[model samples]
Target chain A: EAGVAQSPRYKIIEKRQSVAFWCNPISGHATLYWYQQILGQGPKLLIQFQNNGVVDDSQLPKDRFSAERLKGVDSTLKIQPAKLEDSAVYLCASSPSDWSEQYFGPGTRLTVT
Target chain B: AQTVTQSQPEMSVQEAETVTLSCTYDTSESNYYLFWYKQPPSRQMILVIRQEAYKQQNATENRFSVNFQKAAKSFSLKISDSQLGDTAMYFCAFVSNNNDMRFGAGTRLTVKP
Candidate 1:
């Protein structure tokens, strides 16, 4: 039942350069998320992990955004200096806990020009 | 601080007819949970139905259905018969019980065949 898995689906940087996104979840799942979909809007929760710690990131963007979920099954989301409103579509979800019902991945369309 | 409102940004069903997409949410936490995600165009993020706020029994799956009105907190989503892959971009989410998640600003359904 392979589901959540993301990486370089699409990306283009320039504004301040620096971008990174990657996720791999859905195998026992334990809650892991990182969303930010801004085309027409609808996804915005920048961080959340239940396995390698972090349960929430308070909308992240702590100056440059960051994320990690190492031992809890792949995860990574970074946006160093990118801007242009940080172009969007960087979803990555997984849940079998922390309330349940979530399974998404196939995003990573950052195009900050 | 949970807020998810999808004031129908777009809608147009014709395939087999039948469409209803609308959502309203602003939590005061009554044991939260409500979702209806579906973002096609290859962006993934699916899971078209979910509702559980004390569950007054309103959550279907087959042709997708949801009309949970927990005290008017509202939560609508009805897509029956409609097809053509049921167009996409329809989100309405909110999860709180301490998890605090939110998403909404979407509703671009168009399944006109």
Candidate 2:
């Protein structure tokens, strides 16, 4: 079975600019997640979706960051009016269910100037 | 709230040697899960191993093993016969019944030839 997939391995943007990252989950996976890993730090959960509905996004910065999963398979995370502190790697992961092991994809590295 | 901590910021070992990375976590939930993930320079967050809180036996996969101490709220990863391919940032993570996951600051491990 194929693992989770993400696009645009790298991106660069200036403060106040906008950028987006995409993810395609593993086949038959019911749960998808997005995480942000800043330089010198570990990845932190940004959002989670169970099927096409949001399960947890308590840590998401709703003011500038938003994400959506449609058809329960594909998802997108967008950051508008980016800040230099937003420079980090965005990782996408999927699990068969909320209680299953998670498989991750190569992340998209975002550089905000 | 749950928190994961990796006290070692960096560690090094010669090829074919062994090294261990330390991790500690705080959670009020009695039943939870712990994970060790490896992120190479490629930036793929790969699952190295996982352990369920209720399980008494430690988790091991191939050359990677974990020492899970529930009483102390500690989990340590041991890499045997380390290889250059093992050089990467290793993160310890935690998740409970609520499905909220927490991650540590990560430990950078470099295996020298």
Candidate 3:
């Protein structure tokens, strides 16, 4: 039973640079999610997808943050023109269904200088 | 909108001792789920335990247990015989009937040997 996979584990970029993170969810999972965790804070949901269709993305910064789950297996989150406040850990999680417990991946930590 | 709160920012315990982390949530939904996730320095979100709102038995997972108070909207995690591996950031999360998940600001725990 492989868990959710994400890459790269860490990243560094200057302010206003563009960065992207990738995620591969567990097999047979139907729900995928993206979350952002700032220093000393718990994760906040950025977007959610259910088999290539978006379920929610109210917290996502539409101006610079965008995500896509093509084919419902793998997903990517991108942040263009990164800001210092965007330095955080981006986590990807998957669940068997819309209401099941989630399995998370090792997050991608982005440090914006 | 649902909100979760972890009033404690940090806590320490002697090895083999017990420690408790407090959490409270605000929501109007009757049926939902609660979860406790552990994030070590590695930044992986590991689910420690979970509880369903309809179940009043609370949730116990080995040395980890939860005290869920529906009336008071409180969910607390208790770790007995805490080990060095228990040192991590603990987050309390909530998911409403619509599957909207929200998390608290996490509590950092350190176990001293």
DockQ of each: 0.30, 0.76, 0.78
Q: Each candidate's lDDT (Cα)?
A: 0.86, 0.92, 0.94
Candidate 1 TM-score to native:
0.36
Candidate 1 clash total?
1
Evaluated against the true structure, the overall lDDT of model 2 is: 0.92
Best by DockQ: 3
Model 3 over residues B1-113: C-alpha lDDT tens digits?
A: 78999999999999999999999999989999999999999999999999999999989999999999999999999999999999999999999759567889999999999
Report the candidate with higher TM-score, 2 versus 3.
3
lDDT of 3 at A104: 97
Candidate 1 global lDDT? 0.86
**Model 2 pairs whose backbones collide:** none
Scoring only the A-chain of each prediction against the true A-chain gives TM-scores of 0.33, 0.97, 0.98
Q: How far does residue A111 in candidate 1 sit from its true spot (Å)?
A: 2.6
> Model 1 chain A: which ten-residue window has the lowest total lDDT?
A93-102
Per-candidate TM equals: 0.36, 0.96, 0.98
Over A33-53, each residue of candidate 1 has an lDDT whose tens digit, in order, gives 888888888888788889999
**Candidate 2 residue runs with Cα over 4 Å from true position:** none
Please rank every candidate by lDDT, starting with the best: 3, 2, 1
